[model samples]
Target: MSLITFHRIYPSAIPPMRGDKSALGSLPAAAFQYCEAIRTASSFGWYVFPPLDIELKFDGAEVFCFAEESGWNKLSSLYFEDEFWREWDRFAPDDMKGYRIPYLTTLFVPGIVQIWSGLLVSTASDYSVLVRPLANVVSHRGYQVYEGIVETDRFAPCPLFINIRLIDTSRAIEVYQRDPLFQVQAIHRSCYADGGAYAEKIGLGPPDGVTHGMSATEWDGLRSTIRSAQPLRDSQIGRYGAAVRKRAKGQENID
Candidate 1:
């Protein structure tokens, strides 16, 4: 089994979760019953939340922050200090001099700011990490979170942070400790193991596969992909989710 670990010194920093239960609650019965892909995608990874409750105010050019702990004044970004955590700051590389902050205005992109997750993450040597927005969360917030693939297997182990680009600057946005801001999924190194030129367009095979269009066996497989499942109806609705669950429990393959 693969292992991913997060280290933090603060109590308010939220631990990751398997999925957003709130997001799942928003899904209709139809999705939970028949939409295996949607349901699976929603719960596939660990969701990460904000380290503290903070509100951000943006005015098209810059960002300001408000938190009871941080008082009233902030510019560019707010800093949530952890005196105990700052002890590790001395060990960071010289190049990361001013880059490591609890929160920061990343000038690399316009309307974007980085909020520290308040966790130092590391994955097994054979695994990397994908940091992305929560997939199935039902939110209409005025900001878009970035998705990034990080080589945590070989990273400097700086605390992880999520970047958000403001979409509407007129309204203040609040992030609470309980609300997830992003998701982290570990990817095995085998995903990138095929580094060489391994792909070729020999899709049309000699006699067994698709030569002209598709072989008989291939045609049957294609038809069964959807057609075969249509007959497994529960009352009036399809039993895709139930079928998938049965197969997952080693009951049997659907086809």
Candidate 2:
């Protein structure tokens, strides 16, 4: 079966206040408050994904948080490395150039999946698990209020594909259509007594139940879409991926 991948790139860097002394001073207090809020909310049958790390970047004078990793070790070497910052800066706006020395923290979240799986299953089980944890992270870390540009290719993996079925497809389509980075491939389905059979309309076979399989064309297409939506502002993207690839090649820790 052909699987469609969705990739999204957020253009704005982490806000400045998130790295201020006041923010840090309040963090511990905030953490306790947020945890209580999470527990209380969860008791009412809410799923909350906890914060894994709180990264603060100091580009010399400006302090910002680039990305918050949840549902996994937010403090991994990869996330802390200078290479990660380089890659993140590649996506930063033109005005944010020439910044150095950013502070970074890793927020904690539970249940991070490393393997790829079919859109339906992954979205339903793995992706759904992040909603609460993300909320918790944001509750303490603060909201990322800026809207940045986004681009999508036809074959990028969709992080939210499984959740798509839980809502109205037309509404999904409408919302994604307005976003620069969102892309959706139409699926064809045949209903049966047990369950309906679904396949990509473009002759891609049914979605694999346990595996995430895709054609090279599809994968490349998705990559293209992401690039088109949010072309990297710098070479940081290449450097970051290359660093990761090098580490993986050397049998070093790569996630």
lDDT of 2 by residue, 1-255 (tens): 322222232223211111122222334554433343333332222111111233333222223333434422322222235664577588768775444322222223211112111122112111122211212223212122121111222222332211111111121111111111111222222222136555543435545665456678787866543324345543233333444445757957543
Residues 1-255, model 1: lDDT tens digits: 456888774556777778743454877877766777778888877888888776777778777776566654545655656563465466657775455465555555667878887787888887878888888775547788888878887884647788888778888887777778888888887776667336533344454443344567976866545633456642434556667788889989664
lDDT of model 1 at position 161:
82
lDDT of each: 0.71, 0.29
Residue-level lDDT for 191 in candidate 2: 22
Candidate topping TM-score: 1
Give TM-scores for every candidate, taking all chains together and pairing residue i with residue i. Answer: 0.78, 0.17
Q: What TM-score would candidate 2 get against the native?
A: 0.17
